[model samples]
Target chain A: MTTSVNPLWRFRGVAGTAWFAMVYLYLPILILIVLSFNANKVATIWSGFSLQWYSVVLDNPNIMRAAKNSLIIASCATVVSTVFATLAALAMSGPTFRGQSVINAMLGLPLLAPEIVTAVASLLFFLAIGMELGLLSVLVAHVVFCIPFAYMPIRARLEGMDPRYKEAASDLYATPWATFWRITLPLLMPGVVSGAMLAFIISLDDFVITFFVAGAGATTLPVYIFGMIRMGITPEVNAISAMMLLVSILFVILSWLVGRVKQ
Target chain B: MLSASVRRTGLLAPTVITLFVFMVLPMGLMAWMSFLEPGTYGGVQWGHYSAKSYIQFLYEWDLDDQLVLNTDYVGIFLRSFLLAGGATLATLLIGFPTALYIALKDEKARNRWILLISIPFWTNLLVRTFAWMLLLRNGGLAEQFLSSIGLVKEELNILYTPTAVAIGLVYSFLPFMILPIYTSLEKMDWKLVEAAFDLGANRWMAFRRVILPLAMPGIVAGCMLVLIPALGSYFIPELLGGGKSLMIGNLIQNQFGASRNWPFGAALSFALLTVVMVTMIAYNLRFKRAPGADK
Candidate 1:
């Protein structure tokens, strides 16, 4: 907005600092990806480029099982949370009700609460209920944690939408269900998809909650990576991490694109 | 056609119920258990309620059965606060300029830069911390590069130090700092800045008086986002500090894990929750007083 030709306006130092910050933020991830392909068993040194670690990760049953578990949990949690969040978004955005702010605050509580509290609370709750601390508990916890993430975007989308479309459908004698299915759902699809993608990423990358609530044989990839790192670093760990990072990056991009579609 | 309450209930019931059972109930249970005694083993003892766990946070029983003030847990809390605070400051220094730079860019470039900032955030935190480990270890890339450049005469063995933990925390939470500030800057009305300059205010004075105050909400939000999580983070310190550095998160985790002191763990957790709740309330009150500050 400032079109002045002042000498002070051409400061290049801030640009350089920004670039440096970006590099600092990204260099570790780039290094990890590069190290995952290094032939050396040692993580820090680069003997040469090789794909052996990727193969090693593939052959390892434990890593594969953890990946499978993460996938299942993320998928299930994303689906359930997205559905419920869509319903909630629809409800909250449709009517101006008393106590709506209270409901909104409750929805956001999990996001604001510290992860350790949520983790320990879920752990104790499972113990108190005599429920097995396995994939089911993990799934339930993930759904609860992810609903706020899914709710925000969907609610934003709903609020942005014009109410006239639904009114027109109703004036044409369309039932409420038909009006929803034909009018609302289609418009809300982009937000739903994006929110679900965000939730899936959160569920997939979760460590603290999974570490607390996971029983034997319920290790998610992040939890597995934590255990492996404690033991020692290895190229195989790097390989698995690289794969996880790739998946997460893909989902983030997809979410971004879906979010842009609403505009 | 449905009643307003019925419609509201129908839409919100599923999420509310799920969150209640999983989120609210667990918190309530944790609060309740914090008052009870820890069983000999891992779980809580049912009927014996006491404030011993809460008191134990400040005092410990010696062999002679006298309670003495314990500073070890207090030290851990202070250290956690210091680390989180340091990281938040570091992010502010680095992120403010970065957000400003992005805001000054063209719209397409701004979006790309914003996306780039988020990529690292979306990546698994464990993996990112592991990458830091690989970099900071002896003879690792960071050391090798620094030594090669004659920046250090000795090996860079910062992996297990408090410095490393701070670095990891900063790296982990930097994006949270950047995104909010960028949002504020991007939404900012540059006309006010132009007006300030036209009114004969110098650039520094304009930035100091006008830009900074307008960006306060984002700065506050970013600080909270980075500071709260950094305070409670366990893995960064555990991995980078190599068990030498202990924070409140590690303390709570130990009680729940190996220490098997459930009541003490619950009490520590409640302490953490109390801190977070206070921060949130402060933020809420601030926002309420200055509505549209964030937008």
Candidate 2:
């Protein structure tokens, strides 16, 4: 950590800009969080503090319904996608198979394609097959993109895992299935949990695709918040946004922490 | 005993089937829809194939049935490009230094800085844009602060403008730019820069000659990550750009909603897809050609 190693730290404005950039990123979030507690209806004004906005958000039946929908969709998508992604990760991390590269590309497509395009495509596909547009459709679509988020951590964990435990288990006459159950799966649990947390947050936070796919009676929290913001900015919207932001941050930090577990 | 290959296939089948049914097939359907004629009452008419959707990007049939050069869609695409391009440039300017600053930190501080950057990245895009709306809107924090500081005598009036959209894009994607560049810089051999300095090079020369080239891959990747999402961004423009500052995402949404031209909407999506694919392919080629890149 000598100065000679990276003299660029002394470069004028680099450190200054870094600090400014941090402020730029977090200042508005802080303001929003603070204003969520304001008694004033107007979001801009700094009226006396109150938790009335949170209470109002809770009391609103429409917001409550949307929150319920978001939780259901996120839970279902997280479970299904995490299970499927774990399987895929286990397979790909095993002996090399034919068509591995093709499968890799296919797995990456959802991340590469723009969400708007994916939304439009999913809408057309649903319409073409005459599928009903509802929460089911939203749930199906959520699983598609969530696969990659769920796959990444599990795959990383598999790569980092020592092979010696499985080797030892086999040398002791343990069946392959028994070895996997006793050794591999237990070791991969942290990554699976991390991936599930990530996928859950992503499904919860999604607005663009859910906006297009969700029909009547299928509104999610983000879609509801988007509608509220379009109507006007109120402390209620600020309160709801702050809540969603906090949930995402909590899940993300937990995901990071779980992924960092060594054993 | 089950063979390993059988076990692998069994394990992989669920994800493969899910992606094929949900992701690949839907995209295929979209491509097919783009070729079919538009239905009068929304959706597309099967078996009524036509090239009109793609053609309509540049020309529209006039009253006399003659094709006329229409710039409406083209203009929107251009504006989107300009705004997204501006955002990429701005993020690079701000993000590079920020990334370097983080990379220069000790391991403990580095992790903390990255976490700070990533929290905003993983947070909801809609909420982030809404945060900007609260800041940049008239009589909002930006206006109030600027006027309070005597920097401007009147309302800032920055929100609901392209500038506001640009700001939202830059802010939302800045972390995307920083994280990749920081990854590359953190793994870089600092001794190379020291070597350059020892060889009678100044700070600028060392950076320009040694450090920049080493960081090219991450910079390129960062630019792609920022540009692609910003280009197709829907909510940022909708919340911040108002009615007048329409981007291609809004334009596509309009075709699907108000205009009732599903074919045209599908076509516009394809157009956007083409641009993204080209950018990615170009990046892949450059990356593969880079020295020491694995095949």
Candidate 3:
């Protein structure tokens, strides 16, 4: 512990812990991966080695339907939320407007507060307004939570941005709208992409909020998996979990690489 | 300039209007609904309002003759705090080492380490939660391995405990801790530690005296990122801790769903809001007090 400036002991300690932590963090997924290849309908049983469960999950129309619904919802939520969040980011980061602090807090509060609160609040709001619980309500809920993620990276980019880029565009006789589209959008694309990716993943992973807001007909993938777990489990859930983990790991690497490229 | 600004109603109109309709108004409605009692089937009784539910929360009777009152929401709040605190501590204990190592490593090594960490982060939280269930449940690896090793007198019932909940919560949030710590460690001036070493301090001593102090800001940010959500995470405890686990999140869920007590849930949400606000203000004050915390 006492090799202060040498960098060697620091490296050794850190590397050792990093490996340990990585394995610990990933053990669950590793278990699921091991189970996926196990030839068994029972999650705990190792009947043999087979690709049957993967085929089962792929063949099941209900899971496919739910997953398709989920993809549609996530895409809609991400696109809608990211656009609004970007505009809000632009507005807040621009000239100091009235109620800017309130606006900023409103955007950020969803991120800090638990999904339970947002779910209940949205449920109450929808009820009061007579909106039925369905895919639309789920979309509304996803967009609400996704905004902060989009706003954050975009806002950071905006804050660090030089106003002169827009100014120069204007000086070159570009219309304000044109300048925003041509110059601002392209420059802001990286942050927007990361933020949208974040929004997409959040919408994909969300359960508590989605469970409450999504009604019977609009059951999303996570909710379906949750229902299966509760109603005397299934091994397909494990298979799905393995696939989801793979996708998530891929998405994270992709986002990080994209972020680095922008930098 | 004024005319040009006015012309860009394209931006202002949507921004102002959307925040009001979606963000601000929903919160306001929730606060209002929280003051009213739940109706028979569901929803508010429209005009009725009272402080009764909030008061009752302090003293509700349980299935047992004990004063189980209001599901002891106060206990749930405190337990959540403990859980969050534990997870934050665990994450930092491990994360500090990893981030320090990465920051101190060669650029290529650091990049490789970061990519490895970021991988688990991409999956949705539900997938991550399910992964844990797969690992700890009855038929899963833990029970199988432990039973094989004679670690279990009977079947090990580890799932649905607070320990399981904490594991899932920590697994989900560990990245938040690492990133901030990495940023802080990356920004550190290694020369100070080198100088301290040259002046006769050993490795651990330099790390303790120089690197740790400089890295405190990142640690604090990391803590905030992890702690805030860990306190509020409902799904992890619900799934891993099982149905018996009633964190404040579950309570809130009940209020909106089966319990049909919107008013009490609103009050609970408000309570959470006030706590978060106070903590944030305190955090800002401490940051200001620190000698060069921001810099």
TM-scores of all candidate predictions against the true structure: 0.97, 0.97, 0.91
Candidate 3 stretches greater than 4 Å from native:
A1-12, A160-168, A257-263, B1-4, B7-9, B61-71, B149-153, B288-295
Q: What is the lDDT of residue B273 in candidate 1?
A: 89
Clashes of each: 0, 0, 11
| CAPRI class assigned to model 3 | medium
Each candidate's fnat: 0.72, 0.78, 0.55
Please, what are the lDDT tens digits per residue for candidate 3 over residues B1-295? 4574564455556655665676667778988877787777766788888775677668764578565545466788888889889999999988988787778677777788887787777766776787777778875678888889988757667788998988887888988899889987787777787788789998778878998899998999899889887877777888898886457777677676667677877888767766776877788788746764654
Name the DockQ score for candidate 2. Answer: 0.74
The Cα error of candidate 2 at residue B122, in Å, is 2.1
Clashing pairs in model 2, backbone N/Cα/C closer than 3 A:
none
How much lDDT does candidate 2 score? 0.90
Q: Evaluated with DockQ, which candidate comes out highest?
A: 2
Give the candidate order by descending DockQ.
Answer: 2, 1, 3
lDDT of 2 at B86: 98
Q: Per-residue lDDT of B109-224 in model 2, one digit per residue for the tens?
A: 88999999999978888987898888998899888888898998988888888999999999999999998899888778888888887899888898899879888877988999
